[model samples]
Every structure is written in C-alpha cells, then in structure tokens.
Target: MGLDDIKRRIAAAEERAGRAPGSVTLIAVSKVQPEGRVTAVLDAGHRVFGENYVQEAQGKWPDWRNRWPGVELHMIGPLQSNKAKAAVDLFDAIHTLDRMTLARKLAQQADQQGRSPHLFIQVNTGDEPQKAGILADELPVFLSSCHDLGLSPSGLMCIPPEGHDPLPHFRLLRRLAHDHGLPHLSMGMSADFESAIAEGATHVRVGSAIFGDRA
Candidate 1:
C-alpha cells in the first residue's frame, strides 16, 4: 500500500464517521523513510510529508524542493534548541514547539530568514515524562509567554501513549486547540487515526499504513 491507498482508506474512515471525505490532511510520517518513497508519494499527489529528523530532512528537502516545489513538509518530532535554526530553514511547519526557549529560537531564526512556518504547540496529552510536550496545566502560562513574542501558534499536536484509549486523549487535544483559539489539531497516526478522526482530528500522520513498515 502507498499514498493512494492511504487516501482512499482515510476517505473511508471519514465516511464511516459521517464526516465529509477530504476534510483532514494526511501527513505522511516519513521519518527514517527513504527519499525515493517520499518522491513516490509526491508523485501520487500526496504533497505533505512529515519528517522527524533534521538530518534526514536536510538531504531530502532540497531534493524535494528541486522536484516538487509545491510540496509541504512538517517536522513532527521533538525539536532540540541547538537544531532550531536548521528546522527554521527547512520545514514548512514544526509540530513540537513545547518550550519557551525553543519557541523563541524558532521565532528569531524565522525572523532572520524573513519567514515564519506554521507552528504547533505540542501538549503532553497523557502527561508522560518521556514525551516532549507542555503539560496541559502549563499551557496557559506557556502561551502567555509565547504571546509576548507575538507568535500566533497555528495549532496543538500530541501523541498518546500506546495501550491507552485514544478517544479521550484526542478529545483533550481538540479541547485544548479550541480553548486556545487554535484552528488545527494534529493528532493520531497509523494505528489510532480512525478513532482520532471520530474525535475531530484535523490532521492525521499516516506512515506504516501508507509506506508499510519502513523499519
């Protein structure tokens, strides 16, 4: 299966939920995936691909831009402060803006380049220590600080831990998006995306379901 099959499957998922098909953006998580596969998806008209590593993106994005200039790229992994500048130069959006320091770095770097990619504030939906997201309770304060920098966050993103019922977790992200006036909710992935769609995930990152176990 590939991007075409993923599109049809997502359409079916939406139809099952009584939602109109094509309402959600399918962010193909291409982390550690071959650049050839990314091109194949782009060739199939699936333009948005998500990359988790800056190094992988560094190689793939330039070639992608040379090939499919209209394609969109999103950084869907934890972003470290040292690599913020590289991310600013490459990705069209970063989905893991969880700390004030990193947000500031991104803003400054984006300003240096005279461009601001779409941004997402990742929240720890399950409050997992190992996750790279602001805690639900800490969001308001964090947002206020980010607001001082005049960065209008585009949305909230999260990844619920495995084995948890994802509906409630997805709902929490939706609520966080709405309460914060965010228009996008980046939730779900290959495994629980259907449940996520039912709970109002505006963006679902699909990988194995599309590329089939790149590992």
Candidate 2:
C-alpha cells in the first residue's frame, strides 16, 4: 500500500470508529528507506514521518526539512540517554520515552534549549522482557517520576507481542492512557492500525506499507 491508500484506510477506520476525520496522525516510518522512496512520499504532500535512529535522521532530515516546509518528524525507536539532546533537537515528537534516565536527559535538554518535543511513554503492555518499554504495572510510578523531573508526556505507546491478537493490547493502552489522564495513544502499524483506531489510537506508525520494505 502507498500513502494515499493508507490515508484512505485510516479515514475508513475513523469513520468506523466514530472518530472525527484527521484526529489520528499517520506517521510514515521512514527509517532505513532509500531517499527516492522517501522523497516520493514527500512529493505526494505527506509531511509527517517517523525514524528509528538518531544518526540516520540527523544525516537526512535537516536537508529534507529545508526542502519540505511543515514537515514533522517523530522518533519511534528506543532512545538512548546519550542521544537525548540530538533527538530533542531533531524530532517534533518522540514516541519512545521509556526509561527514567532518558526522561531526565530529555528534560534537561528541553530546559537548556527552551523547547521540547511532544513525548509519548512507551509501555510494554505485553510484559516482554526483551522489549524497551515501561511495563504496564510500572507506568504510574514511571509517569510520576517523569512529572517530578519536569517532563510531561502527552501520549502513551506500545507494541503488542508478535503473533498475539493486538486488540487486547490496544485496549489496555487506551485504558492506561485514560487512567493517567493522557490524551494521545500511539499504537498500531500497517497491520493492525484499523483495530487500533477502533480502540482510540491518536497516532499510528506505518512503515513498509507506505515506503515499501526496507532492503
């Protein structure tokens, strides 16, 4: 599927879910994709994009931002604390604020820079030991710590365990966001975005379905 196809599908999902059109942001994941394919979507008037690596985004997006006015970049991968300054400068939103160290780093950078990107807490709803997210049971405490550090996350994000039904995970994330008074839910991808929309996702990250598979 291409950008237009994904947008149309998102629109349909919104209609099905009784959500207002354009309420869900579509973050076209551009990590590791070629310049040609990435520019193709840019030329198509899509401005929101996601990247998984700080260095990769640093190398390309500065030029792309100049070329494409109004472009918005999101960091959707695990964020290392050492890269917090660079990430805070480069991304318009960060969907992977999991650990407290990274949170403190981001907060310090934000204070130093006088501005900060929108933040989303990545929750390990599946409790996968290998994943990089705050476990569901630990989110409240983590969130409180973040607040104490002066970092306010506007949303919650999660990647459900592979091969499992994602609806339950989506519902859990939505509930978590609600319980915490967070307004946004960044969940879903090309495969389960429709289900996510139905479960009240405010943002969806789609990669291969839009930019084609990475080599």
Candidate 3:
C-alpha cells in the first residue's frame, strides 16, 4: 500500500477520535520484509520503521540510517535479555519491555552506551497464555519496578488476542497509560489500528497494510 493511503487512514482515524492531527506516530513494521522493499519505503520518504528481531534489523538498517539520517528504528518484538545491548545500541525506541530482568539489562546497556531508547511497557491486556507481556493487573507493580531500575518507559504497548474485538483492549491500555501519567500509547496493528486510534493510540505498528504480504 502507498504511504498516502496509510496517512489517509491515520487522518480518518484521528478525525473519528477527535484527536489533533499528527498526534500519533506510524511505525511501518518492516520485519521480515526484504531490503529492497525497505529501500523503496525510504525512497518514498517514510522514516520510522519497526522490526521484530534485532538481528534481522542489523542486516539492513545501519546502512540505511547512514544514508538517511532522518530514519528512526523501533524494536517491536519480544526482546531477549542477551540481545538487550544490541537492541539498545540500534533502536531509537523499544516497544516490548515486558519483564524486570530485561528492564534492568536495558538500563545497564543504556547507561553504558550513553543513550537510552524510549521504552514502552508491554502489557498482556488479553491475558493470553502464549503472549509475552506483563499481565494487566501486574502493570502497576511492573511499572514501579521499571522505575526503580531507572527504566522510565514512555507508555504502554499491547497486542489484543487475535480474532477478538480490540477496542476494549485499546481503551484499557489508554486508561492505564493515563493513570500512570504516561504520554504515549503504542497499541494497534495493521488490522485494528483504526479502533486503536479511536480509543487513543499514540503509535500504531502497521505491516501488511503498508508493505503488502511479507515475502
């Protein structure tokens, strides 16, 4: 899909929600897509992108960033603690901070590198058995633990269970962020982004809608 189409969708969603224009950040999820496709997106003037794995991102984004300094990379997958340093080194933001051990590791990496990527606490709003996130009720204590470890996250992030209406989950995430005095809400994906925006998503990670089916 074209960038214009994505922008239009965003505009329509924001309008429906009565949110001011540009209130949300569109993270074109480029995970598993080829380098040429990513290059095409950059050539089309899109900057922010999300990747599912740190190693996959390392293969292409470093050179791309050198050529286009305006680019911003976001790590939107389950990050392993061992890869925390590499992730902290490359990504401009991290959207899957789900555990205290990872938080502490990221904090250490950030301090050592002298740069800390913006963090989003991933909450398993749906309470799914297979998902990687802090359980909804554990969010408060987890957020507090992150703070104690000096990993002050920007907001919350979640992926509602597949095949379910995501509106309620999005709304809950927004409320959680608000109650915690957080400013950013990174909920929503290609399928339910509109609903997420209507509820109050500050960032939407879209993949298939923008890049077509992954090859």
Candidate 4:
C-alpha cells in the first residue's frame, strides 16, 4: 500500500461510482506518524494531509508548508473548544463540527481572523456513546443552529462503529448530506473507502495505507 496505489484505487472507485476524475480528495492522514514518514509522502508530491492535534500540527506544518507549496491541511480528529482558535488558524478544513460550543468558537474565530476554513458536520450515524459527533436525529436542529450562528458547513462526516458493516453507515451519511443539501461527504477511511465512494464520498482519509501503521 503506497501513495500511487491508493490514488489508482481512488480513481477506480470514482469510475465505478460515476464520479468525475479527481472528484474525491484523498486526505493522507499524517497524525501520530514520524516526521520522516510524513516527509516521504510530501516528497512523493502529496500536498493534502490530515492531522489530529492542533499542537502537533502547529509544531510541524508551518515549516513544511514553506517547503512545499500548495499544501492543504485538514483537521480530522476530535477538537476541543479551547483549541478552536489554533485549529482555525492551522487547518484548511475542519471535519468534526459536532457541538454548539465549538461551532460558536469557530464562528467567533472566523470573524476575528476574517477567514474561515471549510467545515463538515460530524454525525454519529451509529449513535455511539463515546464518539464526538451529533446524533443523526439531532442533525436538523444542529445544522439549523449552526446556520443561525453563521457557520455554513460544506458537508457531513462520520466514523461508523468499529467492526460492523460500514456500508450502512456510509449510506446513512450520504442520505444525511443529501437531505441537508451538502455536497461533500467525508465518510471513508482506508478499509471502507471504496464502499464510501460508491455511496458518494467526496473525501477519504487514508493513513496507514499511505504511510504504514503509526510509529
């Protein structure tokens, strides 16, 4: 599993799904990997990457961005309200907009900074108790609240319950996004990305398949 292989698979998935070439953005999740592995991917010309923590990204990406032009970073992990400001500044997109407090913080930060990153509302399609996402049933209200607060999310994201069939979850996310009129669907990872593409995923986060297992 390497970058080119993953990309070829993505292209095939898009073809099977009737999506245009390059419709799916492959976000190489670089969180928790060694810097050398990240640089290898960067050297391979992968500019779009994902990070989990604000502090870890803040520590490394500024220098990397200067080294590699056109780099885009996405925040693909749980975000705390206190770190909203830094996350806003560092990430080009944030995929875990699940709570009102975080949404309010992001809105305020966007106002102060005069620019906002792309947003994706995380929906708990499986309704897991420990996950960091809004329950599917609550999305209408949550999305309405986000709109009232001036935060217009571009899509919907979800991490299906581990070890279960992911197709159902992916289909659920697709439905939610369609119902809400959102165009992007960030609902896949390394294992189920092909299924997600079939279900209309616009973004697939691949970490180990590209960089190998975390160090």
List the lowest-lDDT window of 10 residues for candidate 1: 33-42
Model 4 C-alpha lDDT per residue in residues 137-169, reported as the tens digit of each score: 999999999999888999999999999999999
Measured against the true structure, the TM-scores of the candidates, in listed sequence, are 0.94, 0.99, 0.97, 0.99
lDDT of model 1 at residue 148? 85
Cα lDDT tens digits for candidate 1, 1-215: 67777788788889988987789899999888766776777887778889889988897688778877787889998888999999988989999999999989987887788888899999999989887899999999988888888777889998898898888889999888889889888999988887888878788999988887886
lDDT for each of the candidates?
Answer: 0.86, 0.95, 0.91, 0.94
- Point out the worst 10-residue segment of candidate 4 by lDDT: 123-132
Model 3's lDDT to the true fold?
0.91
For each of the candidates, the C-alpha root-mean-square deviation to the true structure, in angstroms, is 1.4, 0.6, 0.9, 0.7
In model 1, the runs with Cα more than 4 Å from the true position are none
Best by lDDT: 2
Better of 1 and 3 by TM-score: 3
lDDT of 3 by residue, 30-96 (tens): 9998778878889989999999999999998888899987999999999999999999999999999
Ranking by lDDT: 2, 4, 3, 1
lDDT of 2 by residue, 100-193 (tens): 8899999999999998999999999999989999999999899999999998899999999999999999999999999999999999998999
Determine which window of 10 residues in candidate 3 has minimal summed lDDT. 33-42
lDDT at position 183, candidate 1? 88
Candidate 2 lDDT (Cα, 0 to 1):
0.95
